[model samples]
Target: MAGPLPDGDQAPVDGLLSLEEIKGSEARTFHAYVHIPFCKDICGYCDFNTYTATQLGSLKQSDYAASLISEIRFSAQALEQSKLLPRKFSTVFFGGGTPSLLPAADLIEILSSLEQTFGFTENAEITTEANPDTVTFEKFAALRQAGFNRVSIGMQSGVQSVLDTLERSHNPENVFKAFEIVKGLGFGTSLDLIFGAPGESLEQWRESLEAAIALEPDHLSAYSLIVEPGTKLARQIKSGELAEPDEDLQAEKYELTEQLLSAAGYTWYEISNWSKSESLQSDHNLAYWMGQDWWGYGPGAHSHLGSVRWWNQKHPLSYSKKLEDKISPAVGRELLSIDTAKLERVMLESRTSKGMSISDLEQLEAGAKSRIPQLIADGLIDGQLAIKGRLVLTLRGRLLADAVVRELTD
Candidate 1:
């Protein structure tokens, strides 16, 4: 079993917000992140808050979705009464173990609830995450009719062997078919990929990138594989059933990815994300990297408004039960200190195409200014951009993005 809950994580029925502070909220965009934690098949490497059919025993999809919408209404009513329910949702994102697995009617019902409760922006960028195998022209068509304008499909790899090792259950061909279907239906699309799996080669990664580019997706997210503790993949590596990814090899692949994607006319906006154009960037995610606010609904979901952040109970049944009782289900929360918030800004802003101001970094720490010249001299950042009052990462710096953050924060 997992260890005892951490401090400030003892969840209560009315802990979502202090209620006293809701009227004073200055959050600009109320982005919605509805987490769907059910998956038909759980991937071996995944450590996300998700469960498969057997693990979910008696939880019905419809019931789960209904519980989510309940929280939506609950939060919306509170915000509305406080005159804080700004103009509809700026963006509504359905992310998860496989948001595609939810029945179309259930998805529409949930999304519609968000619209009815918070009101969707006139041009709200509604997006859903999907595994290629669960995608269908009919499903996407229905989604389009329901006001979803974007689909981020998982195209983890074009190589069969890599997919097999990762326990991913879709064909490379399925990725192409799904992309074509979403694009044909006029939905903006993004593809998700993972690199540095055990035994993966630079050549294989190159082919994977090549395959993804051929699809001409509006956005691409390539993440370095992480072997999270307590996961099957981590256990396998620990027990010698699988080889751990080589750090040096992973670095080389990151560099090559930068080269290939840049040549493909995709701008590396975030360390792992690339977009075809500024208009197609994931606005919901931009809210995150920039420290904007959003409200997450569902078991194990997280929410942030200004400096205060909170997450929900992790069990679906418990989450459902709490809403049935009409109580705030937030398990834990923290109010960020000014210093902590600035440090977070430096950490997140350093990884983006929108670079940070040197002055801002110095505000976090005076010594940060002294490190700038040395960082520039080390070629981690462009001297040109630095002179213009920004700290944009060089291709090398991006590969070492964490190091840059540490140096700045230190």
Candidate 2:
């Protein structure tokens, strides 16, 4: 249930802050995650709530932008009132089906509203996800002017064949061009590369790695392909037209990625993300991995706050109507009890290099402690130290993070 509304703010749920409070709290030192649900086309392997060009066009980008701004204004006020922290934002992220497709002017308007509603830190890290085909130098320049200091290009792979197999519109050359343009705009840049696509060879993967490294991005995110249920790729795999990479091959590829990127001076801050410098790391994502609360906006965007997680309707039509009515567009929600919160913190912390604080762990069910030593002995986790208050995951532990977290919570 939502909390009571404060004066002059949107009505709040029983436990969550009022919409106005969310805005004010946003102004403080926290992360802002805005979602853009439009994409040129949804990839077979993708399952995130996304719409193709046809659906996006019908949704009216201008109208949606206006609604999004209103949402921003509301959250900014709520954040300031919540007083989560004394400082301004540490990071802001524009992620989505394809944030790059939005015009620079729209992005600028959003950024300006963010600044006016909730102040940004002097050196705030603002990042937007970009696809190669949609990028242009002029757009990038406008993005830089709009206060975006970081650009994350979704390269997926540098091999044209691999790109085609993944149903990506852009070729390797397009990726390169996008990266060069973003870099020339003076923003810190990162690349997203994936391994274990159907029919990809180890040599081809290595070449992809080499190509990505040649671009000299400040950060890199290498993810192994995952076959989630209900995705088109999963259906193809079931139909025998697609083959998931064998475990052994995928493991080898993973090792190769670690070796190559580390040799190139990138530090593995998390399981999938690597940064050339500590400062180049993605603060917004780290916040999520560390179990901090964040707001998510846009059709089908998800949010988590104080153990209350919620998501909006996925269909653009439904989302547009809700936004026009000035109502909170939540379509689903889960309210966690105190025990669940403790369990979540423990589970989430295990996935990152930063382990959970013992004090926080003590808050978990007493029976959960008996499993800790076994996990540590089995090389599934390391002992506690106080980085952010207690112990964190060791490099080896990170490999089996999800299973270990499940064990702790179960």
Error of 1 at 35 (Å): 0.3
The models' CA-based lDDT, in order, is 0.86, 0.76
lDDT by residue for model 2 (270-301), tens: 78899998888888878887766667777777
Clashes in predicted model 2: 29
RMSD of every candidate to native, in Å, equals 2.2, 5.1
Which residue segments of model 1 deviate by more than 4 Å? 1-12, 15-27, 81-85
Q: Candidate 2: what lDDT? A: 0.76
Best by TM-score: 1
> lDDT by residue for model 1 over 278-319, one digit each (tens)?
998999998888877788899888887756777788888888
- For candidate 1, the 10 contiguous residues with the lowest summed lDDT are 1-10
